[model samples]
Target: MATKKKPSSDQGSSSSALDSSRWEVSCFWERRLQKELMSLMKEPPPGVTVDAEGAGQNLTQWIIQMDGAQGTLYEGEQFQLQFKFSPKYPFDSPEVTFIGPNIPVHPHVYSNGHICLSILTEDWSPALSVQSVCLSIVSMLSSCKEKKRPPDNSFYVKTCNKNPKKTKWWYHDDSV
Candidate 1:
């Protein structure tokens, strides 16, 4: 009689891990997010234009240009938004922030160019896309009840961490 060998636990675990990783790489959320971002390059938001400045021949990093929506405080302003996607994206949200001089000195946006948004922070979900982020920012700029910063804007700006991903922001208002 020939003896049959059973697969070891280590081998099974490794195989399962690989499969999970492969599945993550091909996840529906990632595909949807990428598709959405790509579509924006072709047909952008109203009055907004985005150009991809390839970060070393890879599409991981993008410098997006958004022409502030009309009837907004940012009207006539062309803002630069930086988007950096990780390999484990959709699971880990992209690192997005305003870059360079075009950044608006708003209540929600810090002087260092970090944006304060719920979705970018504690409220992030795999369902959200780059288009949604942009739309949210546009809406943010559009609904400026006043030109001044929020009452706690100074403290938030000073104490806030430079890395948007690491910072946890509280979302108090959904109206804007």
Candidate 2:
């Protein structure tokens, strides 16, 4: 059973107070994701577009469309990014991965669509938004001078968890 109440009035709900603990978690992330989605649609970052329809129906999952930046090794290529948010997002980071038929051949992106970006893992911050993440991904791709998979992409993909966020990412100072 579920009851609906304004987030501002969460504490005032007639429902069990014990449920408030769980309610608050969803409220926090829901509010943050709504704002982030609105801002992304209104003023999306360079070479990026949002799948507004997918977001409207399901706040937990989003499909982001990105165009490879000009002059980059992936120039003129297209890619889709899938962002899956947990109830503790903002405090935690979303599970982001490349999802379409045209996944880019980047050293950080495995053939299984998992990305090895630090912000998506150990270095995530509550201050970061979808726009900033998109920009970071764009920057990563734009700065790349060649198209190649990570040195350990095969081994990692073969034995890694389906959820990219679950893996302990080991970023090196020498990586792209």
RMSD of each: 9.0, 6.5
Where model 1 places Cα greater than 4 Å from the true spot, the runs are 1-34, 53-56
Local error of candidate 2 at residue 9 (angstroms): 11
> All models: lDDT?
0.69, 0.84
Clashing pairs in 1: none
Q: What is the lDDT of residue 122 in candidate 1?
A: 70
Q: What tens digits encode model 1's per-residue C-alpha lDDT throughout 68-87?
A: 77777777888888888876
Off by over 4 Å in 2: 1-26, 174-176
Q: How well does candidate 1 score on lDDT at residue 21?
A: 45
Give lDDT tens digits, candidate 2, residues 88-151.
8988899999997998898888999998899998889999989999999999888887789989
- Clashes in predicted model 2: 0
